[model samples]
Target chain A: MMRITRDSLLSGNANRRSWMALVNPSASELTQAAATLDIPESFLRKRLEGEASRPLIKQERLISLQFQVPMPKKGGTGQFMLVPLSLYFVPGYFVTLSEQEIPFLSQLIDPQKPRKRWELVLRIIAEVTRNYLPTARSVAREMAVVERDLRQAQRHDVVYRGLDINDRLLTLDLGLLQLEYVVSEIGHFLPAEDAVLAEIHEDTRIELSQVRDQVDSDQATINELLESYAYVVHNNVNHLFKFMAALIILATIPLFIPGAVAMNVPLGNFPHWHYGFTVVTGGLVLVEMLTAWVFYRKGWLRLD
Target chain B: MGCQFYDTVEDVWVATERYTADGLFLLMPEQVHQCPQLEAALQRCLEQRLYCQDAEITLRLPVALLAQDAQFGTVGRMTHLTLHHTPRSLAILGEEPLIRRLQQNWLGELRHTSMGELLQRVLLSIIYSHERVARVLVERLQVLRMALKTAMGNTELRQIVALNRDLGELVIALRETGLILRNALRATPGESPVYPLLDAALREQRRIEDGVNLIHERYLAVTNAYNGIVQNNAHTVMKVMTVWLALLMMPIAFIMPWHMMTPLPLEHWHYLWFGLLAYVFGVTLLFARWARKHGFFSM
Candidate 1:
């Protein structure tokens, strides 16, 4: 859908200007917008088709920029979808083209809050970068939940969740890197003497830098959490193995004693006295206790 | 100058400066004042040594230098070695054994390696040594995990915590040293031959970090599992005790009332003793069956 609104209409024609926003635009809509804005239809077509074969920013009579914004995806996996946003800027007109509805663009749709074309673009960029912070925070929270689950029980489900969070955080990092590059490139195209453009450039630079730093910090945290999760799982397996080993030791003692008696060995006066049965029974019990005590003392059994 | 020269090819420290080939100079902490040129070089790279001031192996150059503490083995104390590397010469100030070992191990490479490559080697050697320590920690952790399988006690827990702490400290040291080297490399102007070596050192640093992190994760998981096992064992013990208590109470409750009676109802009866015995045996059998059925003996 294509929504074109004039800022002058809502502001009593004080400063007449128009901006176009395209949400999931078709080829025909892109062509129309391209014709109205005096831009090459191919530029809009390439962007609308989601072709990102060029650098983030391209300069000519009209300036075109392509950058990605973080979008949350639905599923058990806490993954973020990177949606590419294409912007075309001329003297007094600005246009934004996206494959899906840009959630933050609604703020600019209200014609009552009129903004200059560059100012609007800067705000859009800032909003796109800010979008990552919330996603990062949510991912961090999800990681913490997974960590808690891991502590309670080393289950595969928690591990899968942890891996999913790692994947999402990696995606966020990649997207932020591309965004930083784009923002830095935009600074080169701004007029050197324009104070407002310079100020906007500086603000965008600082904002993007902050976002990148935050993403890096989040990535480091996720990495550590994932490591801990793996460790918890390993420790649990080791515990099970240890338990089984102790069980084997316990089972071996009884088996060895009976096997020895069945071999017809004359040890302990076996088969030589009327009270042999009683003696053997008592001896078996005694030996079992001794073995258990020994194992316990050697740290092989968890009797306590 | 009255000095001893250790030859890489010969693998021996001779008490003569006759075979003075351009290579690393090993300097002791005390000998730093003896050689004015070496002393100046140490002052130049003094700031760089701050990060690794307490590290066993540190890279500061007029030539590659290592300061070995004579009291402890090379691995025992952080060898406070000052190593310097210059294009014309390599000077080291450390213990005789350490220098001799280095000479023997890198005999062929030391003879042929350029000064920059030698510097890189020194840095790489430091990183590799730390990496070895990390690997040992990892192996120890594996052993600890195996020990944990059979039982976990306070000692086992302490060992795990200790290993984790050591690995953590190693990771931090490697990172700081790596950063220092990288920054130092960047600060150097023009094209220096040490970039590749520094770059390799950086890579090794990262590898050590990764290895340490893996060990830490495994330790954490194993520790948690060990605690769970302990708890489960405790629970089982409690259940068994409860079952035993219940069983013991039944016989006591049956026998205590007989003793307090003024006259037993069938005391003169011929089968009275047999009946009481049968009754006690039947109740014991029933209670044992019930306890088993309720999962008291499941462990």
Candidate 2:
């Protein structure tokens, strides 16, 4: 049997209301809980079993929101991922189902602190949004490292790291965008159900916007960095091609004049003279040198 | 199954079985029942309920890097190592090079230290050396990056290829070895100072992995750039040779035929034609031979 604790997690400061936390329940347990609550089992089960959906409310009296909270990958590898925290609102009370432990939930929803449903959610969202900062800020830090790597001694490794940061920021960017939509929807659905929640939600909104702004800026910077590096690679290849083209032109010009004159124009008696071959070959070389000098002075062959 | 007994009192490796069970030992994989001590440690571990005999949990790792089994069976092919501590003695097994490396780097003097302290040193020695190798590889890649700024020779190009292969292998080995180490280390208590050391080692391993991956990325760009350089240089030289050769031959083509048809400059025109014909034939044959040798055409 699923134990239902009706003790008020929010009381005195919040209205005289209660919420239940379902910590890792089975299908039968869920059904049992739904039977006790007199709510449809399928509504709760859809959230429990279905993959994470955007935070939204169903119109059939029961309001539900699936908020994803960032949880660290176990063993503390300095990496984290978003896991769902499902909340079901039925009239005056709410029930939560979580896939991961909320370490700060007990402290955040303390009876001493006192909170209404919307106030509780505002605090929860604020806390969960705060969890995103470490990973989000780590991206900014990694971005700086990458920028430094790119600027300094060519960090062949940062190229790989830059790609990782690019991917990480892109993922965070998508998650935050979805969350922004969800946060706004929650505000719309619940409205200022609690004056305290509205007041607290303002604080959460500022923090959210700050994180969102950082993510957006990081995403843009990563895109620009990747593009600039691509352009660098392209420019290197193009520079080589230009050098080759110039060398070909240099060779071609010197070769062409002799080729055109070799059409057996009158050599006069030059072929009969002892110095004939020398004079003609020397004259051709002199013309070639002059062509080379002119091309060199023109700076068409130079590259940065 | 290379086994070396470290006589703790003497502070040196010895072949004799004279050392007590309290002495330290260096060991590799056993040949079934070769070392009763391993069997004892294994049984003691099983008795201690250190970890379930078969329970396995997947540690989320970057799938692109490794997809290795984490069940903690000695895994480095022939070079995998494990440290075993019996009631009376300690031993490290697997990876002959690592075993040899450990033996070479052994701290001299007393061996009356606690098992935990000795084990800490042994594990640190392994990880520290591993991290050093990664650092050296990174330096070599740095040198290569600088070299790539200029034109590359066959030697430098070959070095990059070698570095690419080495870094790729290191990346795989580091992760696999890291996984094995984690699985092995977790068998011990969480509060052991070794746990913090393992964490540090893990952090270093990640840094090294990131560095290796970045260096490996460079391989593709450098290879492409260098290949372009070689091809472009070859193409330019070939173009110049072909253009000049064709041009130089233009006068010969016209002069040889025209002068032969009607030339009143000298007698012995037959000798001139005969010698010139021989020369032209030799040049044609030589050019054909040169082209064929250079793979422009078959002989």
Candidate 3:
């Protein structure tokens, strides 16, 4: 539970973060219905009446930065989503506005007097994004399983899982892009001479950059998995069709022999001869066996 | 009431009282925790656990006072000592009882010669406190390992989950404290009276951090390897069932159509039903062999 001026450095283990703030139950602590800023009032509304994905907007004396941080989907979906968390430095107070309380905000330096607000902000951004690393590792494990028994991916249940992964990966990528943009802009507000703050800034930048690279790598792996998944499914269906075609052709060729025997213009008296039906039937069975053997030898009878 | 120093000449803790007037003061402000205004400002800090594990040193600048704070204590006790250094004086603020105890227990290891060396020893004591906790964590890990060997229910699994959470917190605390000590090492001047002391503090932090990390890695390995064996056994059973059903499907596919139409020789014979049954088994055997040869029906 030890926190410091550099919570970001301490957040190296994003799993055990201390989140005792637990999200205020009242929830409307930052209800700014009427502020003195020239910007749109909708921006201050709790509903966040403007663009949901806005990265940062500094207008006059108010600087508001909005970012999408990843969170697990509710209802035990086993899927992750990007939720918007907005930080506003308006007048004397630094308020963060999120639909639900993100645990990362608890690590912010005393919000009432955040003399080190920039450090906390950068750290929060870095920590929330870095949390995705563990999730990504799990996702890679899932991808490995799907890759091995890829034919099973075509099942109704597993099919949607692939889509869910794709959705989660895209959401992560979008969140990271906003973070990348926000951190670059955050550098301008840093006090020029404080070596400690500079060091923190550099660390945050490196952490975010690494996360971005990881997202890219994960994105590539998933895309490759999906492509292989498609090819396996496609090849299975095509092979099944080929095997059915061979079955049909083998079944049909023997029927022509019986048809030939019943021809009206047969001069050989095949129909009039004794035991003519048995000979024609026996010849038909022979033709069917030969055709099936040919198809099996050609490997067209196998769908596996 | 401050500035108790370890006297090099007398080889004792000296209560000279002159160092207080000399602008070097160790100020323990228990009242800061009580102040209403400061309470709101310290809310973020108060949200952390009462026990102090992560230590951070901040220098209040030329434009501001440089404050370096570290905490030292055992259970039911802790002190958040902030070393606020300014040109006028240096103040150490925290709970008074701990401050008094460090002075009372002093064995002339600290110095008034340089505040850096004193601060270094203060941090070394904090890191030293964690060694006991690490020992407890490692012992619990061993228990969890033994429990998993004869694991009959979810009891050991829950214990593992709980132990992992504890390991994670300890790791974060150790690493953060290590980084703080490392920073102290970098910032202290080699020619200064505190450099070697700072180095010793960093070394102590590293030893603890590395030791805790070894435990963490062992915990992870134990849990992961256990989970893998469980999963692999489960998968093997599932694979065997799936292969059995899949192998039956091949025979079923080829025989069902033939059974629907084909007329066997001596159709009225009493053994005719046996022939059909034998045919089904014969085809199944051949397909199973083929599957085995193709490496498709591995157990």
Which numbered prediction scores highest in TM-score against the true structure? 1
Identify the candidate with maximal lDDT.
1
TM-score of each: 0.48, 0.38, 0.43
In angstroms, give how far residue A285 of model 1 lies from its true place.
Answer: 3.3
Model 1 error, position B240 (Å): 27
Per-residue lDDT, model 3, residue B248, is 53
Q: Write the per-residue lDDT of candidate 3 for residues B1-299, one digit (tens) a residue.
A: 44454445665655443334233344345344433533332344334222121232332100001112232111112234444332333334455555664455422344344455456545654565455455555565556544444344555566566656566666666676666556655665567545565565665566556555655544453354344323333443444455466555544443332232223245578886787778778877886787456433443
Judge the docking of candidate 3 as incorrect, acceptable, medium or high.
incorrect
Provide the DockQ value for model 1: 0.02
Query: What fraction of the reference interface contacts is present in each model, in order?
Result: 0.00, 0.00, 0.00
- What is candidate 3's DockQ? 0.01
Question: Local distance difference test, per candidate?
Answer: 0.59, 0.55, 0.52
Q: Residue B291: error of model 1 in Å?
A: 19
Off by over 4 Å in 2: A1-5, A11-17, A50-54, A58-60, A74-78, A91-93, A148-163, A188-195, A232-304, B1-299
Candidate 1 segments exceeding 4 Å error: A8-15, A74-78, A152-160, A191-197, A224-228, A265-269, A272-275, A293-299, A302-304, B1-299
TM-score for candidate 1: 0.48
DockQ of each: 0.02, 0.01, 0.01
What does candidate 1's lDDT look like per residue over B78-141, in tens digits? 3434566555566665555555555554433344556666665556555555556655665666
